[model samples]
Target: MHLPPPSEHTMVRTERVARRVFSRLNLALLLTGALAGCGGPMEPAPSALEPEGAQDVQAQALTYPSGSSQTVVSRRVVFRNGSGAYQAAAGFEHFRAAGAFDIALHNIRIAEVDAPATREALVLMSAGQKISSSGHSSGVTGQASNWDASCDSVSCPNVSLDGRSLAMKLRALGLFPSGKTYLSVVNDANFDHLFDSDTKQRIVNGFSNWLQAQVRPETRAIYLAGSSRGGCLMMRMAQALRANTALDGIDIYVSSFDGVCRNSQGELGTFDSKINNPVRPWGTFYGAWATNLTAQFPRRDRLHIFHVVGGQEVAPATGIRAFSGYAGSTPPSTGTNLDWGWYKQTWVKWQHKEIGNPYTDPSASDQAQAVAETVDAHLTWLDARLP
Candidate 1:
């Protein structure tokens, strides 16, 4: 049966806050950031990259040099169905060569209309920004419809965008660009309808399944990040990794203000739950998704997860607690906490009590600073443990 829609109270409040934040952030970005030129409308689909006889493909080999500290390789991989070939565009900061190091970013797929263009664009934009700031070059890979497995699911009519398969594709790409990779995955849904049922399901399936393989030795140190639904996928992936022995080496760090998940009691748990009564659908969906993945490797101690949520944000507190319950207690506490006040306090201390109103402050600006600190703390912990 189809799930009920999210509550109006939560939706309305989220929209209101989002609009105000967007307006302010846009102004700030416009003033300080250089906007990328939007490419003309998507051109005709490029030819297929898949070989005629290949199916259930194997991962390609990508070896990093043994003593290579100066060079960091970055790659982007995309899996699409009926869309077109994946092409890598040059000239972005992420792809430019830097001193004593060749930092390359690759795109997994070319532009395809089947998925939400705006979401894809935003991901590309974010990747570009990250590359610019970090001085890394990136590339993209392409795959065709035959590669998608979820579209072949009984619930869906034909090969739809499968998060599981897409994850596999990314894993393959990571083999080559192995040093430190930033992977982004998005479902095939319109940006305006990101919260809809189908879109949510796609994200759940995509991320949960992908997390299964990403935590291996070949790719464990990669950083996980996303926004909105993408953020939700990242959280679920962290939870899944925590429960899987095969993923023990992976260190996950996520910041999602608008994602949802299920508590151990099968209750709806998300930031939106407080405002929206009967979060059953979201809970059930996420629970089912997590259960399926956890069952694949049921041991509790295999995965160690660390995440931060805005205390003011509805889901992080409840969701993290529920996830902690599912994961059971571990040494040093698998979950770390963060909220608006905590961030504000940290900001004020760092700035010598000069900043004001963390709650009403711009989310983008505040979150950027908050996430950096979170990542730094996580890295310190990881270095001591992994090194």
Candidate 2:
């Protein structure tokens, strides 16, 4: 049976580039900061509607190599070390609690999505401005769901969009190793600053810290899934892990669903003319990053990167639609916007949100079926990469 429709706030295209003004901080600046240390005073931002017992946290400043600093803020939880490394921090002891699920010190939500019969694990980063809700019926008796009781409507939970449904489906079909597999959901935390450079940086840092702490070299496999903006963040985190010589030779897989990237000023574009243009900072950052990855990774079996797109989610040639980047236009026939040319592509006959979270828009039964099929296809593509 279908679940209730999500709140209107959930339906809004949170992926749309927010036009709000903020200080300039580009990708280069962020990378510089990651290499440097945190400094400067932080500006206070509103707290997320976090789960109960969540604390009102303060934002942390990260100093970059450029001598400029950006304030990285998280309403629900503030990382002890804003530098984004895997370090022991206060209030982090709960992650080792004697149970299948526990909130890590960085405020990451970890749960056993699958039966711990195997050591493989999946890490998920949901699209921007979304939260975990109750799972819809799977129509299969004794089927497990992706629901987490700790998720509250008031707070932005760490669970990704449609994360529960995906885990349940993968488990039922044996696509995911059911034995001892953990699902770590990383939170974006600040939808209010959805397109801000610091907001996105927080996600990248959180995932990277969690990965460094959780995934051991002996771990058999690691699967990463990201939707919308998260897709880019996942790749960024993977790139960092690859550079870390200590975690050498471990298998890593990435699945990107309609991934899009924005610039420091919260602008987006898919066309090369727009992206590569010096004035259009939005598309330029995305274009350069995608191009770099394509050249370095070359889509090898070990690198396992897959990209899926909603057939209808084409952006305008101008690419800078204030509210919906994918609206008001069609993709250029010249192939300019296909940033990740190396990725094996899968196309789904749905819109952006539908493909990202099929359980959304509960207006038609066929939509549900189509979502199920799309998710099945994505999982199958990922499963084939499993050793």
Candidate 3:
């Protein structure tokens, strides 16, 4: 208490010394903090630390109405050490898988909406006509031994084939657009007999009339797929449809798988040949008729005639060279008149019977992969072309 009464200058000098010591202590603390930060991890810049556009992320597994489920993740990215470098998380895989699924699902819904409300489709079988108990020439009726189409009622319109065929498989896979009523017509080896002059025009015309009656004002297009003799018969049926004035605006598409232009007499004819060595008139007529009808539709991709032939086709029973002639040698014979039909010689090393079967004949397992590929390609073609 007595020391406080000393001179004012002595008090001022003491205060200044205390202030200098406090400043030195503060500087020492700052240097120690900076050195510790350099030894440890540096704090990331706010912008780079968090992923861009990440907000309220809540992802879970999604289950569709069809009982299918998929795991979903919110897209995210992370940066390291305050640098711009980043790595994607599970969201990148989600983008590829979910993106494709969404696209395909969208395409299917769009197709269903765009298809005509009422339309007709046909799957003509390789079987020929059979004399029913009622004495009428009806197409064959029976279930296939394998997973192929079964014609419950032959020559009937809007009748569905119960079992699985190429077309039926496509429908099951949703390749064919919605609202289509499909029918499968069947026959046996006697199918070629209908091409005979004695019955060709009458039988074919009757079949054509039955089919034409099914087409109404609302019908937008006609799809015809056939194998073997049915493929050949489809040409004639198409001709009849072309002649009918009622179906002028309706488009027609034909798919012929291993068709042979053989007359009723079991003799082959060249395309547009009137020489008539075997005197098969229908053969010449069909080629010229197809050329004429296809000429009417000049629009590209409007009407399509597709012919697919198997390269390994040969006589199965006799093991002899047969059916190769139907493969076509030149442009006109290939049904390419003004780009009418697209012909393809497939690499599906299948014999005559196996090519049209629902699956490869069990004995021909070697060709199964090729057959599957061919079917997938055709399905893709139908998907792109169907309205």
Candidate 4:
């Protein structure tokens, strides 16, 4: 079941010194833009198969701090398993309209994965993509399947998903929300560009706006997930939602994977020479905002956050040196590329970080299920904490 990498792109190993120097320059330029309060126009490089107008309908420029700005957006598209074509995740009526699930990916902090997640929408929503389709039959029950509505070779109204191992698990759990919204900015050069305070605000605003217009009153159990910097953003948004009067009456659960998140615990900075500064975002200079943001909530008990990490370290083949800030090689929405690096003494250590409590890193595979399991465990944890 080997799916070849994109013919145009390959994840080859990059030289350490060159990559670091570039990353430093990138990070510096980012900080400079942050301080200057003025940014030049951004160039939109296409990553998905569709044009911007097709991918995002309500396209508009979102202003950012430092005068920097780009078009931040929310989009929905569907991928049917075993089919190579993509369908609209839209026109499905309302938020809880069945047949699809709604999830939020946040990168509200100084840096986040919103860009990569959105850019890779084609790959993310590609029905043919391996991550979503690989060996999903193992999770099926009875002759009927969540992907029974095959769209390939036939005109069926329903969208065929990646069966139970992936999207099906979500649908069965009722976490898959309809009217899917993708949140991210264009010209996302990763790292520094990601630290746009203005764009973050706009994205958060978009979330609120959608809730006002689309979300059905009966919608319950919204699953909000983010990774790395996105994790910080998720927590920030979680705090807001908990206190938000508009979002009241709906249960919100958060799941963060290898995300630099915490109220005031855990260590920061890189582990070894192999690892350049880890994006332990929850406590970075900018991360303090997340802490303050989370604390402002009146009821912390209502918002439950789950932390999960499978293979909480850089891939052995890539090592820390093969790092890319959600670079082109990265797959969308999936948190694999931006996962945390091992905190060992050196690459010589070459050992995987100990799988954390409530999380078992099945190396690269099963991350989706791992996350679902983590959320289930968090619910249990929440129940225990409540009474």
Q: Between 1 and 3, whose lDDT is larger?
A: 3
Q: Candidate 4 has what TM-score?
A: 0.34
Name the top lDDT candidate: 2
Off by over 4 Å in 2: 1-118, 125-127, 131-164, 187-195, 263-293, 296-301, 311-342, 362-365
- Candidate lDDT scores, in order, read 0.28, 0.40, 0.37, 0.30
**Residue range with the least summed lDDT across 10 consecutive positions in model 2:** 51-60
What digit string (tens of lDDT, one per residue) describes model 1 on residues 109-223? Answer: 1122112211111111111111112221111111222322323211122222222121233333222132234344332211111234444444334335533433333453434
The TM-scores, one per candidate, come to: 0.32, 0.51, 0.47, 0.34
Give the best candidate by TM-score: 2
- Error in Å for residue 256 of model 4: 1.8
Report the error of model 2 at residue 228, Å.
Answer: 1.7
Error of 1 at 377 (Å): 4.5
Backbone clashes in model 3? 4
lDDT rank order = 2, 3, 4, 1
Candidate 2 lDDT by residue in tens digits, 1-387: 999987633432221112111112453566467656557545454344321111100011111111111111112232334554433333233222311111333334333233243355544444433333443222110111343333432223333223234444444444443454555443432222234555445455555665566664346556676655555556666665666666556666776665655433432222232222111212222122113344344334446666554423224342321111211144222222222322554433345455556554435774544444345445555644554
TM-score computed on alpha carbons, candidate 1: 0.32
Please provide, for model 3 over 1-387, each residue's C-alpha lDDT reduced to its tens digit, 9 standing for 90 to 100.
355474643543454345335534654676567767687776554454331111111011011111111111111211112353332222122222222222211111000112233554533433322224321111111223321122221111122233234544444444333456444344232343333554445445545654565566666667665555555566557666766666777777666554544432332232332110111122221121111233322342435565544423233332111122222333233222122243332222234345455243536454444344334334434444554
lDDT minimum window of 10 residues, candidate 3: 55-64
